[model samples]
Target chain A: MTESPQGQAPSGAAADVPVAFQDPSYLAAVVDLLGAIAYGEMSAFERLAEDAKMSPTLADKAELARMASTEFGHFEGLRQRLADLGADPFEAMAPFEKPFDAFHARTAPSDWLEGLVKAYVGDGLAADFYREIAAFLDAGTRDLIIESLADAGQSQFVVDRVRGAIEDDHRVGGRLALWGRRLMGEALSQAQRVAAERDALSALLSGGVDRPGMDLAAIGRLFTRLTENHSARMEKLGLAA
Target chain B: MTESPQGQAPSGAAADVPVAFQDPSYLAAVVDLLGAIAYGEMSAFERLAEDAKMSPTLADKAELARMASTEFGHFEGLRQRLADLGADPFEAMAPFEKPFDAFHARTAPSDWLEGLVKAYVGDGLAADFYREIAAFLDAGTRDLIIESLADAGQSQFVVDRVRGAIEDDHRVGGRLALWGRRLMGEALSQAQRVAAERDALSALLSGGVDRPGMDLAAIGRLFTRLTENHSARMEKLGLAA
Candidate 1:
């Protein structure tokens, strides 16, 4: 499996040129990826806020609110970067709204614990997918993609809350485990739709001869890694993934 | 005609021991006031995000999202201050949840223009009311309240959007004017309910002998100021007050 370049390229891939973004197509592809990520952030902000309403306590509500705000921060960062690249952030973001919105609408959590699991499991899968895609990009763009994912640091709070809930009622673990699997299914269908529609993003994963591209097998392994990570996250929450 | 203290104290008041919060009741009152403001921020974030959905364009949605995030930021600041004062931030914010939630529920905007008007008119009224009440506090608390209000900055986008829409369709102006009034009415009803229910908050405004406070006439004058500001905001947005 070819690892997405990230900052760890084989000796000197990005070293030849300042970055892979010099090519207009590469630049546009990067922009498309960033735009998708930015829209994802906006969706997270709105979805998390709606979920916050289901919060059982003020403390719980505050946590979800903080998560929403953090997602907004990432969106802003991505938006600014898109602008810096001479792209209209709104137009850049427009194409991905449907798939993202559909994903959210279909996977809307039924309760607070489910919301937590959705956020944790869903975000984990998306981040892993992006991280894999990040490997085929220039260091700078990959770094930005990775950094945006990093801000969601330590899901320990979500882990504790989800685990604690299941501990209180073992039956919850069974329900939530099913919920996690459904979230993963919805996410994969959405991602597949997005991949079919977004040619540039697909190109990012399967790069050209001049770029660090993933072969068909590597792409399969990327999906494998994403699924594995998702299961690990659910297991962390004591859910059978 | 009175300037909200902000950081200024009269010749003798807030002088004896530096501030009135030395008294336990005053301390509780200040904490209560901060809690209300913090929870107000939380409500604003949720309400603004909901309103953002009614945005006619992605740009407009981004503007409202920025406002929502700013409100969340203010909430975080106030929550931190509550913690610094040895108050449980969530508990301190608990008392305010009902009133703020009621205000939001009763004033949820039906569309983009109405949302803008609500954000403009409703927030303007609330800010004015709080600014007036801030006059009865110590400089530090007063400054914090004032700063939290300040981050809202000028709602120039709302003003421009509403005014532009009204210019395009004059009927919108009349409808929004009514909305402005309805918002003011709902806000005042909620305010009165909160004031009647929260004795500490009421006491904060009508200070005890040791602290600077407003007389009945002064309180009436404060309402006058609030009404005037609300009218001014509506007018700025090209709506009738």
Candidate 2:
């Protein structure tokens, strides 16, 4: 991957760019990907903090605050990494602002339960998609992406609360199942829009000269995996995908 | 400070309590103080995140998010400390929730500039009050309070932005000056209510047998100091106190 067709190391990439990301297109894609993740984390932080205000108990509020803080911490790391790569973090994140904002606006949870479902289901789907893309990146960038997506292990409480609520009344499950499907739809639509708009990010999946890229079949399989995981998550939460 | 009038260490203090905080009253006051600070930090986090949405520039939004994250980090620390002291952090925090909520509701900023002023002035005032109370606590608790109150140094951007707006329009200065005063008024009223209701917390100001407590004159001086600091912060923001 380090040597191109000329049998020499590629040199046009930024001095700080890793050998694996020496391709300008590859570097651009990584930046775009990081930018999206950073902004996603920031948006998640905002939404989670907002949901915290609706918590039924102080303990639940603190838990949500902890989750928000964790996401913000991930954002700080990505911001610093962008600066280290000589990309303006905010500029990197700018292109992603609209789609993310739209997604949040469209899926604004009506209450605390819906918020938990969104956090769990939405984050689960995004994490799955990012993990799929991480397969094509340099180890360093991939590690950062995976670390940023690490579950804070607060999901159990989300699952517990959500499942407990559904058990109290079968009708609650029916309503949340619809909410889960809505979140999945909105998420997929936003993901599609992001893919259509970010050429470099999309190109990351199509192999360049030195990298192994996924074919259309693999891309289909990736989506299948993402959908399957989302379903599994919804099932765990006593909701339907 | 470690010994009582009987020339012995106080008993019935929690086993984990520090020697200087073994006076149950002092311990309760310290717990109350920590709880108030924790809840205050949590509310600040929410307000700052809310303000980030109103930020005119993406850069400004990121800055406010950074400040909000820092406040949440402080809240986490105070929460853990409360638990370590054998206090249910949430229960300890319960008493102060109403006043803090009322303060935020009453002083909700009308615009981005107003939010900036409130963050600067309100946080500055709260930090000052906590620092004053810190004086009556044990070394351990005092250090914890001081650490939690440590500024994240994001205030310079707030100062620059507010002052720049005032420079561009003198009318902004007049309006913000009034906003700053309103914030101070709302904060003071809420704080007085907290003081009036939380007996142990209020007693923290009245030095005990083992510790140097503030007399009424000293108490008056503390408020004077707080008001002076608030005015100074307002002046720094190019506003009237």
Candidate 3:
């Protein structure tokens, strides 16, 4: 859960992709990771737009639209990175479509409050997991991941709106609390399935000959950290994890 | 319609909010105009996002997402300008919402191709109308309208896709040509409703004593230009006017 002890001092944006990408598996894994993140961003954008449509007020709609635009901005970067890596961004995203779609289908929020909770909890969990993976990548890729995962100032808005709704009706809080839990569960199920299927990506965690990677214990700790963060986010929304 | 014959030389970004705004009605009209455009941008963003969800391919979805994001970007600029003009952006948008919403509700696309044609013809018509109004405004607000209405480059993609679909099935062209006409009809109806309801906005055309405004003849010419432009856009999309 801690920063990779083997982490080198920041390289500060290397001129080219680091030499580590010369390894075919490392290259494949990085491509897979970026593709997954990019697709998730696109999905996030679409979901936020849907939420905007369902928003009760113009201000709320504008807020969601801004967040959606921010997600698309990040997606554009990841997409360009995929192309620079000589992978067709769409092709790279292809393998991820089913799992992400399935996850969204299974966890589609029923209303505005549910959508806000999912956006908060689901995005936090994904960001945490990706940040953990970023620890093991080369400097350039790591920097890109950090930038791509930057929050678009939606957390406080979600927290304010959700907590306000709960204040108006306590029953709303209980239902949303349950919704948060379901989001967490569905997200984990899909993520685990992706990890199981993507060997190159999973291998990025298990150390190679020269690169440092997480051990089993470290992987366990990483999940623990992710869970803790998810719980913290839920609590922030005044919902139980 | 031809350019304003009495047009002043471009003042090139006036400071002190232009003397013309000293007129209370002019200020209200400018605010009304900006509010209408801003609300339209937000509406366009939501609609494109909807179309994106209905798109058949990831590439198509990404394209629509990009357009949605672009609309939101313009919305942000207009929102800030409204605030700068001492109008609560949301309050300013309120008066225009019903008409814009009604426009969207009446013309909602039944499928992806219908969505594309609407985007193409609908946006082109709206942009043309706003640009015409821009001609009668102070330089600063005029520049903002011009910038906000700039096309997000969806024209070629929409034209290509819609035309390709038509090429695949001759029936599609006929259906979409009719769709284009409906979009034009619905848009003009909504716009006219808004103009009638918002007196100051309409007054912008019938001049103040010192400032030039369009005569009935000029108003006739303006509609002619808008219709001609709409037909031209449809023709470009391989659809009949």
Candidate 4:
């Protein structure tokens, strides 16, 4: 990952570049998007650590706790990366705090497996979105995003565990599949709410005259990839579409 | 701390070896004692992570989560150490799990300050006890015990925050002081119960053969030291003894 050169636009910069960074609207929109995602990561870490207690045995408990700790590492990475971009991590994240928080509060997991499902579904989408955005950033910012992406290790563990549980208990598949769908719905709904309010960010996704090839179709492609991965994960867990 | 020499008389060894380890009658008692402590640490970690949400900001939340993570690290260390001693950490910690769980389950902190007070008081006692016991063990076990002591970085932060709160509202001090007292009472009561049930452990504490140098006096000294430190902390926070 390389940081974008300051002042100098890329040879094939997106047409929307003038609107994405130079325009106040675009900067605010980008900040809003980054802020919401950063806050979500922070809250997710908290939830994972708390949910770890639901493990049935000491070994499971230890593993879950370790997994949860990785969230903080991810949170820190995101925060520092945001700081590198000249944004206060808190300020960038503050606006979406309430909505993201309410989402989790309303859907708190009832058990260990449910928590794992939340991690798998929620973090999977977050990582996908982040990876897409990282594609447009400068070297330093791209590197940070890539580093932050590594924080999803524990989420992968959760996916494996949830899949194993479903395999072992075929009856659980229906309920968990429904749970996964709900998680995605809530996540996408919240994301749409964020995108609706941040036009500059939407512009960044749509790429501009500077970069003729960028557009909402790219965003659509990103979402398609995320849903595909999510569907495969559900099937691997013995859950239906 | 060095390992006790093989074939040495148990009486000649340091008073730290719970007689239950050598005496069948004392095994259950020792296991129950260690298990309760282990479980207590586990529960505390979970509660602390949950409480981290009350932090006024994301950075604060991260700090609290990091602190909570340390508890899990300690839990793992203790678990591994127990396993090395041929005891299952979960099994050894299981007999009193209900009571210990009930204590924490009932006393869950409602706010950041309350949580900090719990950490400040609870961790103080644990560190005190571990420090004293370390003196009685062989070099390796003692070093392991010392190394497993939970770091006070998070607790100190909590203490600072709690103290800052008390400075703004004197009444806050009274409530926290009372909470601290109750926490200590429950902890001491549980300790006594475990002690009474395990005579070899009791004997190990009481010293090899007689009462003066036994575990009780050591416990008493530990309590004194803990209370002294607690008093200083309370004074710093403007809380009444």
Best by DockQ: 3
Which residue pairs in model 1 clash with each other? A4-A135, A5-A135
User: Which stretch of 10 consecutive residues in model 4 chain B shows the poorest summed lDDT?
Assistant: B11-20
DockQ of 4: 0.45
lDDT of 2 at B234: 86
lDDT at B170, model 1:
97
lDDT measured at residue B146 in model 3 versus the true structure, 0 to 100: 90
Per-prediction TM-score, chain B alone: 0.90, 0.91, 0.93, 0.77
| Candidate 3 docking DockQ | 0.78
Off by over 4 Å in 1: A1-19, A151-154, B1-20, B151-153
Give lDDT tens digits, candidate 4, residues A84-166.
55678888888778778778886788988887777766776777777777676544555655666674533556657877887
lDDT ranking, high to low: 3, 2, 1, 4
lDDT of each: 0.83, 0.86, 0.88, 0.68
TM-score of each: 0.91, 0.91, 0.92, 0.80
Candidate 3 chain B: 10-residue stretch with minimal lDDT = B7-16
Model 2 stretches with alpha carbons more than 4 Å out = A1-18, A152-154, B1-18, B152-154
TM-score of candidate 1's A chain against the true A chain = 0.90
- lDDT string, candidate 4, B201-227, tens digits: 566455553223444566777778877
Candidate 1 retains true contacts at a fraction of 0.57
- Give the alpha carbon lDDT tens digit for every residue of A1-241 in model 1: 6785564664533343334557888888888999999999888988988999999998888888888888888888888878867799999999999999999989888899999988888777878888888877767677778878864523788999988998899999999999989999998999899889989888878887677788889888888888888888888888899
Q: Between candidates 3 and 4, name the one with more favorable DockQ.
A: 3
lDDT of 1 by residue, B114-194 (tens): 888887777777777778888777777777788788746258888888889988999999999999899889888988988
Q: Report the lDDT of model 3 for residue B240.
A: 90
Instruction: Return the DockQ of model 1.
Output: 0.54
